[model samples]
Target chain A: MTRLEDMVGAAVRDLADSAPNAHDLASVARVRGRRIRRRRQALLGAAAVVLAGAVITPYAVLDGWNGGPRPQPVASVPPSTAPVVPVPSTVATAPAIRKDWWAAPVRLPGDLVVTSVGRREVNGPNGVTAVAPKTVQEGNVALDRSTGRYRAFSGGYQGFDGAPAGRYVMTDDGITAQIGILDSVTGQTRQLGHGSGRGVEWSADGKTLLLSLLRGGVRLIDAKTGAAVDREMPDAIALCPSYCNFTWLPGGEEIAIAQRDPRVERSEALPDTVRDIRVFSVATGKPLRTLPVPGVPAGSAAWSPDGRYVALLPDAAEEDGIRIAEVATGRIVATLPLVEQVRFIADDQILTVRGLDVGVYDLTGKLRQSSRLPQDFLGRGISLGRA
Target chain B: MKQSLEDEFTAFVADRGQSLLRIAHALTGDRESAQDLVQGALAKAYARWPRIHGDAEAYVRKIIYNDRASAWRRPGRRNEVTVAEVPDRAAAGRHDQDVTDRIAVREALLSLPERQRAVLVMRYLEDRSVEETAEVLGCRPGTVASQASRALNKLRLLVGDRPVSMGGAR
Candidate 1:
C-alpha cells in the first residue's frame, strides 16, 4: 500500500464501518422492480397493438382501392439539405489581421458579462449607484461597453448568455427553480419554465431562449413575449430523460444537443465516454443531421457572424484548446489555445480571454493582437455575446 | 420477482448493503445521497435479478458507478459550483494535521470531474487493478491512467503542494 492510497483509505475509514439502516431496502427495491416490470409490460402490449394496426390498416385500404396504378413510393428525405461548401484545409479564410485590435476600445456585438473584483460605480437604472464587488461571484451584470452603462441582475444569474441591451436568461436560485428572461430595463422577470438555468442560451438572432431543464430536456421560448416557441417540438418527458446540453444553431429554426452512445449507457463502455452532436429542427423536433464533432456545454458554443462556422469549447480539446469548425461540414477549421472564453468579434476576428489577458486571433489560429484588461475590471469573467 | 428470487435478493442485501452504502458515500460525499444511490442501484438490480443473480454484486456495482457518473452532470447538482479556497494553517499537533489533511483530500476529491473522481475511488479505495477498472468503466486502459494522473494533479493543486507520492502508480 502506498502513502497516497493510505490517506484515501483512511479518509473514508469511519464511513466504511458505518452500520446499515433499519429500513427494509429489499422490500422497497421489490416495489420499484414491480413498477418497472409493469411499465415494460404495458409498453410491450401497446407495441403489439400498434403492429397489428399497422398490418391490418394497410391491407384494408389496399383491398378496397382500385387505382389505375399504385402511386410511386415517395423518396426518403436526405439527412440534411444544407449545402456542403468545404474549404481547403491548408488555406486560411479569415480576413487580414488587425495588429492594433487591442489598442482601440473593445467593441462587441453584445454586452460584456463581468464579475467586479472591487466596488465600482457605473450608470445604473436611476443614477450612478455604487455597485458592490463580487456580488454574485460568477458575474451578475451586463455591461454595455459603448455607453459605460451596466444592468445588474438578481437571482444569482451566472451571466452566461445575454442580449444586446439588458435582457438575459437567468434561473432563480430558489426552492422552486424558475427559468425566465430578466429585462433590466423594466426590472421585471417573466418566467418561461422551470430548470436549473445553468444551461440556457439565446438564439443567434437573440429572439429565442433555450433552457435545459433539470428534470430532463430543453425548452425554447420567445425572448420578448415569454411565450413558448416550437410548440410542436417534443416535450421534456419524451425527449431526453438524462442530462442534455442544448444550443441553438446559427438560425433559431434548429438546435444542437449532446447525445451519448447507447453502448455507454448499457455499461459496455465508460459512462459518457463517447458523444455525438445531434442537430434537430426546432419546429418539428426532427433530427436533421449528426455532427462528428464532439459535443460541448450550451454556453461554450458560439456561431460565427456569417453563420458558416461555429467555435466550441469541446468536451476534450486536443491540446487544451478551442476548435473552430465549419457548420455545414462539421470539419475542424482551426484550433487555438485560448483556454478560458471564446467569442467571435467579427466574421473573421475571434476574441478570446485566457486568464485576465485578452487576445485577438484570426481563423488561421494566429494571434493578431493581445492586451491586458484594466486593473480594476480584472478577474475571472466570461465574455458573453448576443447569440 | 418470484418468491425464491425475492428471498435470495433479500439475503444478499442484508449481507452487503452497508458496504455498498459506504462506496456510495465515498462517491457522493453525503449520507443522504449515498443512501439514495445504493437504493437506486439495488432496485435496478432487482429488476433484472433472475438473470443476474449469479454475479449480482458486479451488476449492482456497475449501476452504482454509471448512475453516479451521470448524476453529477445535473445542472441542479454541483456542476456550476465554484468553491472558495481553504486557507492553510500551521498544525498544532499530529492529530489536528491528520484531520485537516483528510478533510482537504475529501474536498478535493469531491471537486474533481465525475470520471476522474470515479477513477480515483476505484483505484485507491477499492484497490482494483488498472485493467479491471478500465473494463468496469468501459474505456481503454490508457484512458484510465491519464484520468487518474490528471485527477491526482488536480487534487495536489487543491490540497496545496502535499506530496502525492506516485510510488503506487499502476
Candidate 2:
C-alpha cells in the first residue's frame, strides 16, 4: 500500500476501535432469532400452503341478457365555477403588509390532517400564561392575537408568532425556516420563499426579513418592497461549517449571528461550538464587532430585549453556563450552569427551557419561576410570549 | 420454506456477520454504532427471512445501507466535537501517520451524500456487482453506476492522491 493509503487505513482502524461493541451482531442475532422462529411457525401452517399455491381465481359469470358486465355511459356536465382564486405567489416577492398578506384568520383546511395533539400550557416571565387548545399539533396551528383567529401555516411545520405584527416562522426539520405572514385580523396565510434556507428573523420595524442561505451568507428581504439584499460574509465568518443561526435585536439595526469557525475539527456533522458572535449593522452589512464566545453551542442565540446582553447555551461545561456577555465589552458577565436554550421575555427576565421545564431567569443567572409542560410539548416547538 | 429459511439465515450469519459489522464500522466510523447497524439489519432480514433467505446476505446488506442512509437523513443527529486549535505545522505533521490517513478516508466517506456513499461502499468495498447493489439499494443499475461514479469522484477530491484504486483489495 502507498504510505498515504496505509496512514488512512490505520486512522480508520483506530476510529473503528473506539466504536462501542455493544451494538454488535449479537443483538441482531437475538432479534433475528425471534423473527425467524415466528416466520417458521407461520409458514408451517395451512396459510403458507394457500400462499404458495394460491392460483385460486374467482370468476364471476354473468348470464343476464346473455351479456357480461357492460360499461355505463354518463352525460358530461359543465365545469363548476368556485371563482378560482389565483394560486397566490408561493414566493414572497411583494412587500409583506397586513393588506398584501393572503391567508388571514385561516382555518384548518378540510384536507389538512392533524397528526398528533396534546394539552399544553406555556408560562412566561411576568406571570403571562397562555394555554393553547389541546387539539393543536406541531407545525400546524398558530394563534394570531391581532385577528383573534387560529391560522394554519401549512409548510408541514407550525409555530406561534412570538413577535408582534402577525408574523411567524415555520421550520421543517427544525433547521430550514419558511417565512409565513398571517393577516392579524383575517388569518389569511401567505408563505414566502420555498427552501430559500433558514434563520428567518424580522426587523424591528417588521419591514425587513433575514434569511440564511446554504451556499453562504444571509439574505435580507425588504418585506415592504420585496427587494432582497444579499449580504455576503467571508467564508471564514461562517458560523458552522454548514450553516449559521441568526437572531435580530429588538432595534433590528444590528443582527447577532452564532457562527462556528468551519476550519476546525467538528465533533459532529454540525457542532454548536460557536467560537464567535458577530454583530453586524443591517444597513451596511458591515460587522460592527466580532466577540469571542467561548463554549457556546451552535444552536440559537437570544439577545436581551434591551439588546445589551447576548446569552448563549454553552457547549462546554467548564467554559460558562448561560453566557451573559456584554455586546460592547465582549466580556462574559455571568454564566448560568445547565441552561440549554434561552429566550428573552422582558428586560430582566429570560425564559430558559431545559428538558421539560421552562424557567424564568434573571440577568444575574438566578431562577425566578418555573413551570412544567406536558411531556414532549416543549420538545415539539418552543417560543416565549403569545402569538 | 420455513426450514429452508432457518438454515439459510443461520448459514448466512455464520459466513457474513463479521464482515457486515466491519462495513458498518466503516460507515459509522464508530464500532458501537456499526454493531448496532449490523444487528438491526440482521433482525430486519431475519423477520423477512422467508422471502429474504433466498439471498439473505444481500437482503441484510440492503437493510444496512438503508439504515445508514436514514440515519444521515435524520436532523440534528450530527454531533460536533470541538478540538483545540493546532498550529499549522503540527496539523501537517499529524497527517503523516497511518491513523490520520484512515481518519481522512473515514471523513471523506462520511462527507459524501448518503446515497452516493452507500453505492460506493456496496459496489467497491463490499465487492457487490452493480446489479446486485442496485437491487439492494432499491435503485436501477444505471443509478447505482452513476452514484458509484459520483462517489468515486468525490472520494478522489477528498483523498487527493491517496491512491483509491477500485481494483486494489487489502
Candidate 3:
C-alpha cells in the first residue's frame, strides 16, 4: 500500500481501538427490527389495535432496560368473567397514574407565599417536605407535605438550594462563613466544621458534599456527619478563571468538569468553547480521563442512575436535543430527537422537556409517554430534591 | 424457524460485527457513532434477513456507506471532529510518531467532505477497488477516482507527507 494509504489505514485502526466492544449491538438491532416490524403490523391492524389499547408486544428484554415503569394502564381492569355491577352515576372514575414531579406547577401566590421562591421537594422517596421562601426575609420556609404547614429556617444561600433529605448546609457570612448543616425536619442547626465556604453541592448519591471555599479551594465533607473527608480535589485547571462548576458522576467517586475558555467573558462562551470533558478521581485529585466532547455540551449534564451513561444538552446553536453518551468510553449512544431539558427518572428512562410538554423516553430515544407541563411550572426557577 | 433465523443472525453478527465496526469507525471517526452506524445497517439487514442473509455483509456495508453519504446531505453536519486538540509535533520517538500520524490523519480525514472521506476509507482501509467502491457508493468509477485523488491530495496538505518506510504504487 502507498505510505499515505497505510497511514490512513493505521489512523482508522487507532480510532477503532478507542471504540468499546459493542457486544449488545445485535440485540439492540433486533429490538429495533421488532419495532419496525410492529410498526408495519400496526399500520395493517389500524383501528382494531388502537381501540383495544394495543396489547404490549413481548420482545427481548435488554439487561437494565425496563422501558420506563410509568404511564401504566389507568386501571388493571382484569378480564371479567361475571356480569359487571352497574355503578351509580356519581361514582368516581379509576385513579390515574401519578404524574412526574415536574408536571405539577407551583404558582407564587396560590400554591406558595409570594415571598417564597425556589420551590424544591425534600425528605422521603415521595418528597414529604418542600422548601420555599418565607414571607419574612430572615429565612426560608420548609413546608411539610403531610401536615400542610410551613416551618421557617434561617441562613442558607438561595442559589445553592437543593440538598439531601431533611438537611441542608448553610453559612452565616460570605467570606468567613461558619458552615452549618440544618435539619429542616426538626428545627435544629448544627455547626459542621470550622471552615469558611461560598457554596455547597451534594454528590449524586447524597453521601458527600463539595464545599466551594470563599478564598478559592474546595473541600469534600461527609454529608451525614459533616466531617471533612480527606480526598483529592480537582486539578488546578478546573478551578481557575471561573467558578469550578462540577457535576458528580454517579456513585460519588468521580466528577466531570467541562473545560471552559476563560478569555471569553460572555456567559455563553463556556458551552460554546467546551471541547473536553475532564473526568477526575475524587480520591486521587488527578484526572482519570479527558474525553473529547462530540458537540459543544451545553447546560449541565445529567448522569444516568447507573452512571454508565450521561445525557448532555446540545449547544444552543443546534436544535434542542439530548445526546446520550456512554460514560466509560465517551461515545454518543443515541441522541434524543428534540428535548429542551432532560434528567434520569430511572436507569433506562429519561424525563425530557419539549416546549410545554414533559416526556419519558427509553434509552433508544423512543418516546414512551408525553403529557403537558402545568401552566405555572417554574422550569429552572425551581429545583426538585436530590438533583 | 423464527428462532433459527435469529440464531443465524446472531452468529453472523458475532463473526463479522467487529470488521463492520472498524470500517464504520474509519468512516465516522467516533466509536459510538460508528456503532450506531453499524447497528443501523445491521438492523436493516436483519429486517430482510430471510431474503438477504446470503449477501448480508455486502448489504450491510452498502447501508453503512450510503447512510454516511446521506449524512453529508444534512447541513451543518459536514464535520464530526472529536479530537480535542491537534499536537504540534510528535514526541522524539517512533511510537509517538505513530500516534501523531494517526491523530493528524483522523483530523484531516474528518475535515474532508463525507463522500471524499468515504472514497478514501473504502480505497485504503477496506482495500476495495475503485469499481467496487463506486458500486457500494452508487457512483461512477470516474467519480470515485476524482474524489479519492482530491481526498488524498487534501490529506497530504493537511498532514505533512512524513510517510513510514512502506512502499506501494496507488
DockQ leader: 1
Candidate 2 Cα errors over 4 Å, as ranges: A1-134, A137-139, A147-155, A158-184, A194-197, A204-207, A222-227, A235-243, A258-273, A295-301, A316-321, A337-340, A373-378, A385-387, B1-170
Candidate closer to the true structure by DockQ (higher is better), 2 or 3: 3
Judging by TM-score against the true structure, name the best candidate: 1
Scanning candidate 3 chain A in windows of ten residues, the lowest lDDT window is A52-61
Candidate 3 residue-wise lDDT, B1-170, digit = tens: 28889899999999999888888877876544576678777876787889889989988888787663223111111234422234565667978877777678888787666678788778777778889998987779999988887777777767775654433225
Clashing pairs in 3: A116-A133
Q: Measured by TM-score, how close is model 3 to the native structure?
A: 0.39
Provide TM-scores for the models: 0.53, 0.42, 0.39
lDDT of 3 by residue, A232-350 (tens): 34243332222233455555566555654445453211223344567666776676676554432222225654555567544322223567766555566667854434555555566
True contacts kept of each: 0.32, 0.20, 0.34
User: What C-alpha lDDT values do all the predictions have?
Assistant: 0.51, 0.45, 0.50
Greater lDDT among 2 and 3 belongs to: 3
Please tell me the TM-score of chain B in candidate 1 relative to the true structure's chain B.
0.86
Give one digit per residue, the lDDT tens place, for model 2 in A330-369: 4665566433346554434555544345466666676666
Worst 10 residues of 1 chain A by lDDT: A53-62
